[model samples]
Target: MISAQLPILQVLLPLLAAPLCAILRGRALPHALSVGTVLLSLLVTVGLLIRVESTGTISYAIGGWPPPIGIEYRVDQLSVIVLLIIQGVAAAVLVGGGASIVREIEATRAPLFYALFLLNLTGLTGMVLTGDLFNLFVFLEISSLSTYVLVALGTDRRALLAAYQYLVIGTVGATFYVIGVGLLYMMTGTLNMADLADRVAGVEESTTIRTAFAFMIIGIGVKLGMMPVHFWLPNAYARAPSVVSAFLAATSTKVAVYIMLRVVFEIFGVPMFLATHLSEIIIGLGILAMVVASVTAIFQDDVKRLLAYSSLAQIGYILFAFGLATEPGVTASVLHLFNHGLMKGALFLALAAVALRAGRTRRTDLDGLGQAMPLTMLGFTLAGLSLIGVPGTVGFISKWYLLEAAFDRDGFIIAAIILGSSLLAILYVWPLVERAYFRKRDPALPPVEEAPLPMLIGIWLLVGANLLFGVWPDLATGLAERSALLLLGGAR
Candidate 1:
């Protein structure tokens, strides 16, 4: 018998292990459990993905009850793709972060770090796997609450303030999401996402449903770090411990974007809204994010904040593709989702290594780093180049597809915006490369050594993956295309 328990075990292993991490109280023990739990989850994710692909969609009726009556855990194409990215990237980050985390966070707090990290993992996995909307919100809260605590764990005093600010903003976002879910429940009398999709289709013109949709978008927008709603992100990324920044950058916002896609394309009945102006709203916001955030990123002095702003801009590209609401557009968005996770994860780990070796990450502080820590900075440069959409890198593939989609819609102006933003990315990234390589060495600072073996191995894993995906875009794009169709209410 196929274990109906696998899905629950997938989540519970990490969820239940979190407290044990704290109890084991041994520094090495927690790290071992964290890595082991994530690896096991990755295996589970792979099994689920293959099972869904081969057997068609599988919905495990929680407690053996049917949907709209009992909770269901549905493994669909879209969810499977997200599940793979979350668990896969998580496993990679934990491998890369072993040494970096120990250096950056206090040893006494190591167990707590692993505990919170596991809780966050549980929340993200739960958010993706559940078929119920209210359950999504509950998982969202679990992720956000754990994230706020993780951010606070930084050694920097400012980490506390950053976490507090994120707490206020994140709380407000979660409250809005709950209100939206409440409204959705009021409209359909059912909280199951699939059931709600069926019901919302019949009431396509209802004002209540539309309002609920709007609230949910705004709520998820904050979490996704969508523009104007994204004020909390830069500081949180900049001030949090390096490992936290890397993990959150790789998975958190990407999962939030998955929620938005599910709501817009799956739950909302895509055919009903395809003719509406909602795409224009998304396009407008995305354009604003691309132009404004990229411009802002170009001017940051701190490397971490610069990457944070760049992340906001990258998200704009993903959303822009989604806003186009075409197969090509959605496919590009999904491809970029995976690509950006790799790029940002590698970049942040490199940054952690720099901060560990040099005691700072200010752009000026990075002067002559190429000479001192050639391998580390080379990894950073490669990831940065990918971010610039250089050929033979994952970033280039995403930009090529996004621009292609824009052209398909005869959106020359938007195409120009996309290209213009790529140039802005160049402006931000090139300066760091120049400073690291061309500028003279600072005499007061000693020669930098390579990042520890664990850090190098971790960073290389992501770097190699980034290049492999770039060369063979078909791997991700094919999966994304299939997932995109499933998201569009099973549209063929």
Candidate 2:
């Protein structure tokens, strides 16, 4: 009986624990609750994944009611991978990122930080699991609102402005999504995603439905930090406390991408993708994001900002894969979803350790400190290599899939562009290597040692995953393939 409730329990646990963390209102208690909640959530996801694989999609209704009337939580191939990434990142970052969080956030506010962090996780998990369109927006707000506070918890004064900027932008994005949902509700008289999917086909040809689709996509795009609308991300990531940046960068946009997949492929359906003339637009934007964001990253002096821009570029590749709307393309997008999470989690967590030792993460701050912080720098290096799509790394697995999709979709030209854009990763990534290992230390700062053991273990967990999955990618690949087929099936 309890097994049937995993779908709701996965989200409910974090949702309930968040307020308890706030109520307890102390460092140790809140931290323990946050860590315990995340670890429990991760275990729940694993169990759900096992059940979904053996039995197909699992849908649980709330209050003893059925779907289209009661709120529903759905777990399937598409959602499980992302839920795993979210909770896994949270467990790793929360358990190990404690030192960095304490260093950056005031001791007084640390309890609140843990509380907000749990709420953020709750929102992200709810967003992935909910089958109600309206509830998804609620979760989006829950997550976004929590994130705004988390970002502002940074020691820097600029964190306030960054959080404000994101808050304003994020609200606008949410409003746009709600407007779309309202239109759908009016048309179908239902807020359930499965119900809407069934009823939408009759009215999708209408102008109002088309407008709703466009609005929802743009709204989700803003949240995902899609190109041209992504000005808020770099500063937000740069100014947030180190652990917050690591968690948000690794989890937030990746989940938004999945929401896009669910919305565009499953809800709007693929016929609409091509029929509405949005496919080329999505593909073009992806191309622009890859080229433009990568170029922008090469000029960033702040290591966190550099990684932020790199993330935008990574989102482009995922979008491009999805724009193709083919089995291979969808598969590539899902694969990148899992793989990019591993590498970015590793990179950002390593940056957390870097900031702890060096005081700042500017290009200058890392100079010759590689010798001082070998394990931290080493993790950063491995993650960076994966970003560059180097062989025997998870980054390579993502690129290889993207290349395959490109080759199928447009032949040599798009494939060439994919390869060329990957070269841009090298340009941004190499500078850190040059500064960290090549230059001598400035001799002004005091001697420093490697990152804390917990931090190093967390970073290596992700880094090890990058290599293990790269070498033996069958598990991730298998799941991606199945998820993609289901996604493409709806579109077809």
lDDT of each structure? 0.87, 0.90
Model 2 lDDT tens row, 1-492: 889989889889988997788778658888888888898888999999899989998889988799879998888898998998899899989977988987898878877788899989989999999989899999999999999999988878999999999999999999999999998888889988777888888898998899999899999999999897999999899999999999999999998999999988888899998998888898889999999999999999899999999999999999888899888999999999889988999999999998998788889988987899898888899999999999999899999999999888765887888898889999999989888899988887777788889898989988999999999998888889999988878534
Task: Report how far residue 394 has shifted in candidate 1, in Å.
Answer: 0.6
| Worst lDDT 10-window in candidate 2 | 483-492
Checking candidate 2 for backbone clashes, the offending pairs are none
Regions of candidate 2 where Cα sits further than 4 Å from its true position: none
RMSD of each: 1.6, 1.1
- lDDT assessment of candidate 1: 0.87
User: Per-residue alpha-carbon lDDT of model 1 for 88-194, expressed as tens digits?
Assistant: 77887888788878887788889988999999999999998898988888899999999999999877899899999999988898888888888888878999888
Estimate the TM-score of every prediction. Answer: 0.97, 0.98
